[model samples]
Target chain A: MKLTDAKAQFISSWGAFGTHWGINRTMAQIHALLLISPDPITQDDIMEQLSISRGNVNMNTRDLIDWGLVERVLIPGERKEFFTAEKDIWKVATQIIKERKKRELDPMLKLLSQLEQIEGDKKDKDVKQFVDTIAGIRKFGGQADKVLDVMIKADENWFLGSLLKFFK
Target chain B: MKLTDAKAQFISSWGAFGTHWGINRTMAQIHALLLISPDPITQDDIMEQLSISRGNVNMNTRDLIDWGLVERVLIPGERKEFFTAEKDIWKVATQIIKERKKRELDPMLKLLSQLEQIEGDKKDKDVKQFVDTIAGIRKFGGQADKVLDVMIKADENWFLGSLLKFFK
Candidate 1:
């Protein structure tokens, strides 16, 4: 395939993949575009390339920045703002894992902890089942939380290399 | 908290969490209901408890079954079929990982492979960047694929035990 067609395919596929994982389509496409670009791009350039409105480019870029996956860039004499994504895929993956652990897993684990304290007789089947399920999920989530913490803190080489070997 | 209230909270929380991770609300709610129920429940019971339509219950339950997280159970003397979720949290997590690996990750890696072969001069910055991005992603995806494969094939005790120890 030609470079242009290949780039389009990657952007579209990444957008679809992002939607499946709860991120917006346009946002992922923009990220995809930035990931492969050799230089930082302007919002106007993003609008023209992705066929999105200025408002959309503004909103999703802001979100991407908040997620720590993208950044604003200042050109020496340019007026329009430019943006760029973190080109290192390993850092990008770790950043996502860190944010999601904070945003989703931590809070869910908190809720599970609270649910585990529900007042009920342990002998009751309903109570037993509820407690057991909550405890099980809490244990699993705790394990995952620890694992992710290590991943977020460890260097890419040490973590992935150790993990791949351990799995093998 | 009262048992009923606690149950309600758990169902709502689980449904919300599921939506964040790409599962539909109703389906996750139904799965949550089954996970905590000591006995298998019928479609009508799910509808009444979750306040959803029969069609919604039927569709989501079928999907849950397909994902290997829930199963149909035939009672000795009942005309209506019953359903129960795989209550082991580890098993449930592994099943989901397996299904998503098959459905999403596998296809994405395949696309990345084709994109890696895009026709371009290596010296061109755009071409170089694009190829590098695809190659980086492919390598990461390959690692994840292998890790998930190990997790899927592993017994709950052995895998989590080994993983937790390895991480520590």
Candidate 2:
């Protein structure tokens, strides 16, 4: 495929994939564009390239920055702000993992723990099932929490190599 | 909290959580309801409990079955179909991982590989960055695919035990 066509395909696909994972299409497309760009780009550039509005470019870029996947940079001689994505995919993955664990997993685990303490007799089958399911999820989430913690802290090469070797 | 209230809270929260991960709210709510129920429930029961329409329950239940998280069971002499969720949290996690990898990750990795072959000079910065980004994502997705395969086929106790130990 032609370079421009290939680029558009990648951006569109990435946006769709992102929506499946609960990220908005525009934000993901912006991220994809930044990922493949060789240099930082301005909001106007992003809006023009993606055919999105200025307000859209402004908001999604802020969200991306909050997610630690993108950053704002000052141009050497220009007054406009430029944005760039972290090009290292490993860092990108780990950063997302860290943020999600903080946002979702930690709170869910805490709630599960509280729910397990619901007043009930062990002999009641309904109570037993509820407790058992909640406990099982809590345990599994705890294990995942620990695993993700290690992964976030470990170097990508070391972690990936070890995991691949272990699985093989 | 009262048992019924607590159950309601759990179901509501789980549905909200599912939305963040791209699962629909109703589907997640139904799954959560099934997860905690001691007995298999029928379509009418789900509708009454969730305050949803029959059509909504029917569609979401079908999707839940499709995802392998819920199953239809025949009661000893009952005329209606009953549904139950796989309450073993490990099984639930593995099943989801298996299905998502098949649906999303596999296709994405395949596309990335094809994108890597875009005609371009390796020395061009944009070309180099695009190729590198695609390669990195493909490699990561491939590793995840392998790891998920191992997890899916593994016995729950053995897999979690090994992973916890490895992380420790």
Candidate 3:
């Protein structure tokens, strides 16, 4: 419960959780440090707290900013850039979902669409079989996308109210 | 958009995403394959479809079963385990969250608690400072855990209702 012990433990656990969510360990740890600080924290302070090298800190900070989960803070008289995490956990989760869909989901959708145009499958049994196989996957992927879209855009109370519908 | 091109692209993108997700490449590809199949697929079929070694197919299939994302469905009168994915995307997401929390969150919580109990300076300035820093992190981690607990309880309607409230 002591302050110093608390800081180290926070950094360590945040780092471990990062890998599970497809993030680098150190990146999440730095975010953890920023989350609890009452005021903006400078890069120099971060380096000292986490005991990481300058380059590693710089790269991961950039990544966190890119993910829209952390932001730079400007102190009126301060020269060094300070950082803080996005405080609303729900918003943080939303930003992550949107970004991942844009980066990962959209591309897969485009690829699946393009595959539907392939020809020559009727001329060869093997080619036909391969095409059939891919068509199936494309169908599944599209369905999955629709499911994500539906979950995201469905009316308020959709998740709880429709639980029985899905079960049936 | 040729079927050939589409299949190739799907395999590659899915595999890349899997690496980020800690599922590795071949394992994800195999999962992708099974997800779309109209018929029950055997281990030999998986190996051929994935173009992976028999051992790779054997290992990843076991992993899929372990994760509860994929199941070894038995044929009516056959010996080989026919594989299939849990096609419900909601169920898929839930399983992933549960397994990941077990692998990443639970262990980190224990570690953080252990690190928090480490004794430090009661009177020394630096000792007091260090301990306070770690404590701040532990508090943040606890807050994060609270958010995740609510998320674990969420279903479709719960997600939508919460998002609507938060959005407004």
Ranking by TM-score: 1, 2, 3
Pairs of colliding residues, candidate 1 = none
Q: What digit string (tens of lDDT, one per residue) describes model 2 on residues B1-168?
A: 667877998999999999988899999999999999999999999999999999999999999999999999999889999999998787799889988888888888888988989998989998989988888888877877877877777665676668644432
Give one digit per residue, the lDDT tens place, for model 3 in A47-163: 998888999899999999999988998989888999988755445555776677777777866866666567764676545645565565556556656655654454356674475
Q: Against the hidden reference, what TM-scores do the models get?
A: 0.94, 0.94, 0.66
A7, model 1: CA deviation in Å?
0.8
Of all native A–B interface contacts, model 2 reproduces a fraction of 0.68
Fraction of the real A/B interface contacts present in each candidate? 0.81, 0.68, 0.33
DockQ comparison, 1 vs 2, better candidate = 1
How accurate locally is residue B144 in candidate 1, as Cα lDDT from 0 to 100? Answer: 90
Candidate 3 is graded, for docking, as incorrect
Docking class for model 2 is: medium
Q: What is each candidate's DockQ, to 2 decimals?
A: 0.63, 0.58, 0.21
Where's the lowest-lDDT run of ten residues in candidate 3 chain A? A159-168
Tens-digit lDDT string for candidate 2 (A62-138) = 99999999999998899999999998877899899999999999999999999999997879988888888888888
